[model samples]
Target: MRKQLINPPQIYDGSPFGMSQAVIDRASATVYISGQVDWDANRQVSCHNVAGQLKKALANLTTVLEASGSSEESLLSLRVYVRGELGEFIGDIAPILAQYLGESRPSLTGIGVSSLAYPEILVEIEATAALK
Candidate 1:
């Protein structure tokens, strides 16, 4: 699979936040990952705050990606679910995401929801990727 991250000159660059305006993927198979929360190996909520939970959730997502024979660079898109006000937490989210993904800018979406799978899970992230 081949993946291209696109940040058109006409639009604002999203690379700083680990996101692209769009993605171009040429692949024979696509991987649809389930929503990953901040669950540890013991199936316990790893964090309580939004930022902390998001960090752990991203780690879990990465594990899933690797297990699927794909890396973060192959990620096509991400749908982030937040339990509370996004504006309050975007300050914490952007930097962590950028550091985690580096130059692999994939299309990202953040949605504010009432709750998630667990009451303690402040954030959940689901991803789509091209198989390596």
Candidate 2:
């Protein structure tokens, strides 16, 4: 798995992500996942809050990763989109992420967006995972 930093130097230096000092180095065989929502396999909208949706979304991401023979530990980056304030949303999902990812949290980016794919949905997470 590749090592990704929370805040790469290039991101800070006015450069694109392709060139980043925070990226100590990188490995290959990355798996890209699209934005995951709160829907279940039955196509039912599960949770109303960010935490519940996040859990389901993470589970969805895990399914995608596993299908490609990868695990959560192989995550190189996680980009999270929230419909509101960071503190309000993250307060619910952070602990779940801590438990799911264990020690390696992976590089994270959280943004406050106007809305999500669904009106009730508050959080969506997209990931890039590298295989060892």
Q: Which segments of candidate 1 are over 4 A away from where they belong?
A: 1-27
On the 0 to 100 scale, the lDDT of residue 120 in model 2 is: 81
How displaced is residue 16 in candidate 2, in Å? 32
Local distance difference test, candidate 2: 0.68
TM-score, per-candidate, Cα-based: 0.77, 0.74
Query: What C-alpha lDDT, on a 0 to 100 scale, does residue 75 get in candidate 1?
Result: 86
In model 1, what is the error at residue 113, expressed in angstroms?
Answer: 0.8
Cα displacement (Å) at residue 115, model 1: 0.8
Best-performing candidate as measured by lDDT: 1
What lDDT is reached at residue 56 by model 1? 85
Quote the positional error of residue 20 for candidate 1 in Å: 27
What is candidate 1's CA lDDT for residue 31?
A: 66
Which whole-number lDDT from 0 to 100 does residue 132 have in model 2? 49
